[model samples]
Target: MPENPVLDPKRIPRHVAIIMDGNGRWAKQRNLPRIMGHKVGTESVKDVVKTARELNLEVLTLYAFSTENWKRPAIEVKGLMTLLKTYLKAEVQNMVENDISLRCIGEIEKLQTDVQKIVTRVIRETAPKREMKPSLTLNLALSYGSRSEIVRAARIMAEKCVSGQFDPEDYSEQLFASHLYTGGLPDPDLLIRTGGEARLSNFLLWQLSYAELYITETMWPDFKGESFIDAIRDYQSRERRFGQTSEQLQAE
Candidate 1:
């Protein structure tokens, strides 16, 4: 078992997002194919999800694959899709038993029909689970791009306005957010990126505007429960002002 800090429930982030990176580089260092690194990285996923659920996290969004990822070699893309399908199929029973529901926030239609079927089945099977603390949701951002998500939301809002379903007087930030892919979920309070990367990499741009970022040098395959604990601790140490001055925050 991994030793971890006892987090304060009041300060714990309601939603956590991760950009899992460095698979290819980790594999290269070992003189193995990149696919092998991804395979090992899946283990890290399972560990992190289990830990998050144990910690009572409300939502965990993983940047599993991006629209840009499709530009990789055909064989590598195929391998990734196959691995994802296999993992999803195998994890459905575990999800049901643990009360962890699955959700996909991306161009899900872009995925192969068989893979989509597996995802839909798992989601349906886990939908009725209500035993988990805080109701865990594991969001996989496959074929996702933040810019496209925003544009899609904008298009929907525009159509509503044109059809007289929306009024200018009813426009608000809350309304805009409701049309996003992450519609009902709270914005991520913490965004973590592994493998030493510092950029968002076009992931969750609008949603993460005010999220606390925690970057680490550890690669995805090596990141586990302890690593997540460290990040959460770091987040707890910081003060979120949300554009207010320190004095203003102190006065509040």
Candidate 2:
């Protein structure tokens, strides 16, 4: 792992979100089955996670599968689920050994019963490790759609109001955010999309409100640890004023 020469230790992102894209395209380019691209992408996942842990990143969120992903071919969906199960089974030990907590932020219950069982088991098994402040949390956005998540959060808040457990007048950005799927976690400070995608693609709409966006043409399967470090370094070079003018930032 080569150190990123330009990364500032003082300005590490508290949360980093990634859109791992182009698996099928990567495979198509190589004249291989799409699943083969996914298999290699899993290797990228491993490398990225290790790199995040080494950098002491507080939270790392991966756009693993989206609610819209169900529209893909059935065989591809099944293969993805199988691959997820296998990855979970194999990585639980690595997560524990590294004091990383595995978390899911999507409609996980909608997964196949068998896949759900494996996900649940791994989550339970890794729930106890906490060696760092944020414990290098790795959140997989499975079957996740930010719009649906926001709607669900609103529904819950509405129900709370109806039940008199909440006061509508007490609402604030913070209060409403607490109802989100990523309620307790910090909003992503940096959002990286690979395989040349320049859009959010409906992932983390609310949480990425002010996130610095980095788009790379590298396919997910080929994105390595050094690539991740480069993203961080790029992020460190930008100014994040959060609505403040440059003059205001300088004055402060």
Candidate 3:
């Protein structure tokens, strides 16, 4: 870690989201199997977790897998699922020990029964961790889309309205947010997509309205601690005034 290796806590983003991309490309560039890229990417996860905790980031959501990813070859999917199972099984104890609570948001029921079992077990076991909050959305965009989430929320609200749950006047941004999968979690303040991508790819569509975007060329396997820190540092240097002009922001 760099000495005083931190951005100002006051200005730090309360929540950070990342789209980890380019694992397969990285593997290919090195003449290795694609699974090898994913394996190496796992190493980057440890570094990012530690850094996020140190930075006092309240929430960190990672786009681990997408609904669209299922379109890939069956063997690749199995490999990814296997890696997920092994990683979750191996990380449960570490997550609890680190006080990093494990949370998931997605149509996890679609996962194989065995994988679901391990996931449920890990969540329960790490439920007591408080060191840091992590909400990992695996198999996201699979049966999960921002539009779908928003529509679901609206439907819930409509049902409530019909049932006389409350006045429709109560349906503000805050109220609508309550119906979201990330309802209790703070909205991501910063969103980064590695591998030089700038698109959202359907991750956290509603939560990143005002987020600062960071795009990097580093592949997921190569995106280690230092790379993450560099992005944060870059973020710290930015001027986020929401919608205000510089003069108005300065006056505030």
The C-alpha RMSD in Å for every predicted model, in order, reads: 1.8, 1.5, 2.9
Better of 1 and 3 by lDDT: 1
Per-residue lDDT tens digits for candidate 2, residues 175-194, read 88999888888999999999
Indicate which candidate wins on TM-score: 2
lDDT of 3: 0.79
lDDT of 3 at 236: 92
Worst 10 residues of 2 by lDDT: 126-135
Deviation in Å, model 2, residue 195 alpha carbon: 0.8
- The candidate 1 region of ten consecutive residues with least summed lDDT is 126-135
Residue 79, model 3, lDDT? 86
Q: In lDDT terms, how accurate is model 2? A: 0.92
Model 1, residue 218: C-alpha shift (Å): 0.5
| Error in Å for residue 199 of model 3 | 0.9
Residue 23 of candidate 3: its Cα lDDT? 96
